[model samples]
Target: MDIVPLLDRIGEPQAAALFGLITGLIFGIAAQRSSFCLRASVVEFAHGRLGSRMAVWLLAFSTAVVWTQMAELSGMMRAEDARMMAVPGSISGAVVGGLLFGAGMVMARGCSGRLLVLAATGNMRSVVSGLVFAVVAQMALQGWLAPVRNWIAGLWITPGGTNFNLLTSLHLPQQSGFVIGLAFALAALWLARKNRVSLRVLFTASGVGFAVAAGWVLTYSLSQVAFDPVQVESATFTGPSANTLMFFLTSSPVLEFDIGLVPGVFLGAFLSAAWGRELKLQGFEGAGSMSRALIGAAFMGMGGMLAGGCAIGAGVTGGSIFVGTAWLALFCMWIGGMATSWLLDQRGAVAQPGLHVPH
Candidate 1:
């Protein structure tokens, strides 16, 4: 938490990168160990079942919400300064983009963060899809698609351009997030009990949330002490994947949080998979599956850029802090995911994961 000394030793950018590495490491290990995936959870929901997958996800989501709220309440972090709050956002983008991202994740059979983690574990299908995702994300961010993203996002700006906190917008109590998080935690516990989820899995899932909190505290702490300004942010994959890609392609690369975060996650996942004996080379089932994954990746790349976040980004990170756009996006994601899952089921493919991995 005390980052001034670290800043003095390595300066601001390096310090921030260090924090991102640490955060990503924790998230990767936890996510891999716990088998956490929003796609899996959505699959369960689509079938009208609350299984271990649902339990793990709810625990992670609630944990992030609780810890993030507590940090802000205790004055350990200024959540308000985070770009999710301070910057103008897009309502139109959230609705449209969330739907696309939700459907894309179903087809891809994983979210952006999930793809990266699986790729680190030697999932070849994920590797190809992830690469496609990063490239498309780069295009969306600054290449041929920028104008489209900007135009769509410009459709509906945040009320007054920035005064749209979810809690404030809804006139809810100040501590509503904490209260709701506690409720969700209790529900998660009950579901875990019913689903027979083990304590080890739950603990690992909690680490996923802890990483979100650590990301916030670390970056905010650095901003207060660093000589140059640093943006306060937490974990997300779409933008960072695109940014890391650019870092590698550029003549001159800079070390920053996004750069550190991606490789840290890869290292963490590789180590975790090796330790767990879960490392295996898996590829797409056929051309059809490969096409599905690639198409899904493209949709996610575009949607994540337009929405300003992916599942982990908006659904967990921004949702924890009660961002209005984030919650709306998260809600729409569930709807999109469920609807896509149902359509796939009707088609008899269920957009079945290109290759099989243990649940």
Candidate 2:
């Protein structure tokens, strides 16, 4: 029958966290196996090569879009109840925040999700960067930097913001939206047809897509629990990272789904790295490198808060749901990342080409 009611009748919050953990584990394992870094994908695409990584990202996005829509149409979920609903769409915020986040990912060498995975695999640089990311994200979301974020947001909020997708704007039936989303997914996969994709990429992409969809479904289900309040969301890292950090530092006994998801990713990645023999102890070069990482992470934290999502949160998860803010942020992040990548190349300071375990 309806598992949502069943789950609510049993253990509510813990069950939600368990679902998030499962999703996070799948996402982590896939990311580790495929080396699915968005920055890396951007760099590969910039080189005029159709990268499977990018394709995987698109696949994940399209899959989530279709699944989420289907769920909504089936009366399983309502996207309007998501956390992003209250946040007014700010194109300026999306563009500037995305640009900053993209540039930061270049310097940090991974988005928030990737950093979580890397940190679990003994990458000290990622550990440091993750900490900075969490702390700064916390600040921007609800701490001292909140005023700055509010001020920026107050400057350029869009009026009459539509639901983050074309389906809603088209005023079409949900089935019509599903068809369109399915077509978009197929098109994205077809465009990546030329790329020499591997089984790992396919598996990783599917896992990521499922994880995103699962987040929506799980959170939506939890929202129906009469006693406990849960927001409808999916696998986003920015606010989750901050929330996770806050959980440990505060006296709250309740654990949200994201807290479990974040740690589960780390655990899965750690195990995957150990299995793959990719795990290694590594750190930044010196004070200069550390300084750069801190600054970059700071940018990501602030940008992620303003844009309302990070790479995975906005790019993949939000994109899956076809949120306009996410789409715009993803575009700006790409531009900002590409510009930074090009600049670093010109300065002869770009990291060595090809992915590898931290040294």
Candidate 3:
């Protein structure tokens, strides 16, 4: 309740920005090294390959759940402290948003995080996707689509209407949710290892999960301190997608950009690319590819808004907390991606020349 002491201890804006930078750096590194992308994973899965991408995603989910639980049990944090848990009706939006985001991500070839990391690595197509995502996200958030979003939000329905985290709705305790999440993470690691994937791949995938969990812990926990009482700590693509666009446009606003997990993710990938010598300025080679990236970015923005998060936001961070909406959003996203892929395949859209795998 009392944040003055906490603020005095950490030094608000500076601490928050620093926290973001560190988290973003780690996320970028993991993403660059592992090529951790939800779009790629879903696409590959649909294409009949049991690749390590999905495993990496699951690992992140499990790690988040376990770490969050540990934090709560140790009195290091509180679940009620997060914004997602405080808004249950948003579950409806999460599902719809996820479905849209999933489809868009598939069309665009990556999610928000992937786009940022890829853009940092000099992938031109990713740069375009990132730009489109940021722009459209802003439009959806406060520009053209705000009214529609608000209207749709007003239509949400649930019995009792109580704010329900996934665990609460399922009649599961916080401890149980943590256990389940950790168990799943361990299982994912085991399965991934059993596949005889290269140690580099294995480490990269697992490390991404750890980085994600650490991001939530650092940001949300830090935000809770008195110095900077952030209402929530989350990792999703939509808000940043919009913020990135705003930052680019209003560069002279002297905008106090809070360095958070997403920025760290971008920095992480930049550093990783630098280390690997993989950084290069690459751009869309085909009109069709550019179109796809634009359309996909729009979809990701709208869908993320509806779903309440993207791969990291809902799929890993929120999902780990067992938010009811996160589960719905995750499945909807998968379905949306699969649906989009199928539609594209039927139209022979995916077979276009220059449409190479990003990872």
lDDT of 2 by residue, 249-296 (tens): 988657678878998899889989999999999999998778878888
Pairs clashing in candidate 1? none
Find the candidate with the highest lDDT and give its number. 1
- Tens-place lDDT digits, model 1, residues 1-359: 67677677887778878888999999999999998899999989888899999999999999999999999888878778887888988998999889999999999999999999999999999999999889998998899999999999889988675727777777887789799999999999899999999999999998899999888888888888777778889999989999899988999988888888888888888999999999999999999899999999998999888788999999999988888888888888888889988887766653454533222
What TM-score, computed on C-alpha atoms, does each candidate reach? 0.96, 0.88, 0.88
Name the TM-score of candidate 2. 0.88
> How high is the lDDT of residue 146 in model 1?
90
Question: How does each model score on lDDT?
Answer: 0.88, 0.80, 0.72
Number of the candidate with higher TM-score, 1 or 3? 1
User: lDDT at 188 for candidate 2?
Assistant: 62
- The deviation in Å at residue 225 for candidate 1 is 1.1
- Cα error of candidate 1 at position 255, Å: 1.8
